[model samples]
Target: MLAATASQTIGPYWHLIEDDTWADLTRFGAEGETVVLTGTVYDGAGSLVTDAAIEIWQTSPAASDIFPAFGRCRTDSNGAFRFTTLKPGPVAGLGNAQQAPHIAISIFARGLLNALITRLYFQDEPLNETDPVLSMIEDEARRRTLIATRTASGAWNLDIRLQGDNETVFMEI
Candidate 1:
């Protein structure tokens, strides 16, 4: 029999139980590099979910060699995970729709055995206005959940709420 809360294990892609795939995220950081993607995951009660894990992937500027994928990191005591990666470039979208240059996000928490799929769009990207997914969301407040704002240093920070105010845009896939 499966664990009572087995369904909350998140997606297999998170692979938190496994250690082979874990990488030195700071390895990619350069001296004085202030670029960091920081965010916190919370449960339905608005409590921090320290046990959760988050993985993010994106194609580099040229959208080339998107294979083998990017990186994965687990949340710390504050339900936060940070990754040091170059800002991704825009990628083609479905049909005639074009997507903004954003990072594809997958989240897994204690109550979710499967990873919730989503994308994080940069706030500075003008393409966000015409992006297909953003356009699909008619609610301005709901659409804002998917956009990540940049800090004074040009690095970005996006806070994710699993089940509270400003919840991230989780895709069915």
Candidate 2:
């Protein structure tokens, strides 16, 4: 066996803070729809990015909810992250249009001081057919890049590509 080497001290804020409020507040039931948000965080070079913070938020299906509706999680060694969230309802879109049910995702990494915003819709969501935002993208394959799919176990799995081929489209505002 190899012996451990002496290590140098790190920064003062190296410890993590505990917050149990990360649990999904959405109620899950027989008629209620649920999605497993799973994805791999990556760098611009297409390498797996570990230990990056990924935060996602969406308006409640109830629609009467208040602001600051979001959830967050960190990626593991495999650059995989997952979250259990309720399906969002249609929200007001640009001008007189409306958008489909989608979850607003933001990525925070070493180089990013502010999070990069993106949205994830479902492949089978009927609202996608009428979504104004999705309608702007003429390419079906390009639009599908932002959509996630459900697994055999009833969880939604979304593989996020930071850069290069098949990358998830990031948006401003």
Candidate 3:
């Protein structure tokens, strides 16, 4: 009989299995409104998690042969990650409700039992007011955690906090 081996967590060495091209969703000549999303990951102690891996999934505005609808990026020494992709449109939610345009995010890091799930929404999008998920978050401050701010250079910025006074709102699934 074969004995079961111990399960291992995905650690800082994820880059070993990561493809460099996975960081850019527009690599195959996808045409649309392209934007850059940038952010940093912080741990419970407020220190940077320099080796976390972040994955984002979003439906494109239109059918495209180039857009893969998913991308992955590894945090740098400063815990920063960036992705270049097209802006997504609002999607249908449960019971005929519409969800705001957003990107679904999954974060993998050292010391984590499982990947953290979250969503990133654009700050200036008016549709955010009626988004089913956003509306469900009663705490205004906590809801803000899911919104990404537009930078002066036209990039969207979002910071993820594992824990603290400003901990980000992570989804259960």
Top-TM-score structure, candidate number: 3
Task: For candidate 2, list the clashing residue pairs, or say none.
Answer: 36-156
TM-score on alpha carbons, each prediction: 0.77, 0.76, 0.92
What would the TM-score be for candidate 3 when compared with the true structure?
A: 0.92
lDDT of 3 by residue, 32-84 (tens): 78889999999989899998889999864644678888899999999999999
Model 3 C-alpha RMSD vs. true structure (Å) is 3.3
**lDDT score, candidate 3, position 85:** 91
Runs in model 1 lying further than 4 Å from the true structure: 1-34, 62-68
Expressed as tens digits, the lDDT of each residue in 1-173 for candidate 1 is 75655445664345536453432333433232325677777777888878766777766443233233366778778887777666666688878777888888887666685778888888868898888888989999988888877765756778787876777778985
Better of 1 and 3 by lDDT: 3
Instruction: lDDT for model 1, please.
Output: 0.70
Q: Per-residue lDDT for 34 in model 2?
A: 62
Estimate the Cα RMSD of every predicted model relative to the unseen true structure.
5.4, 9.9, 3.3
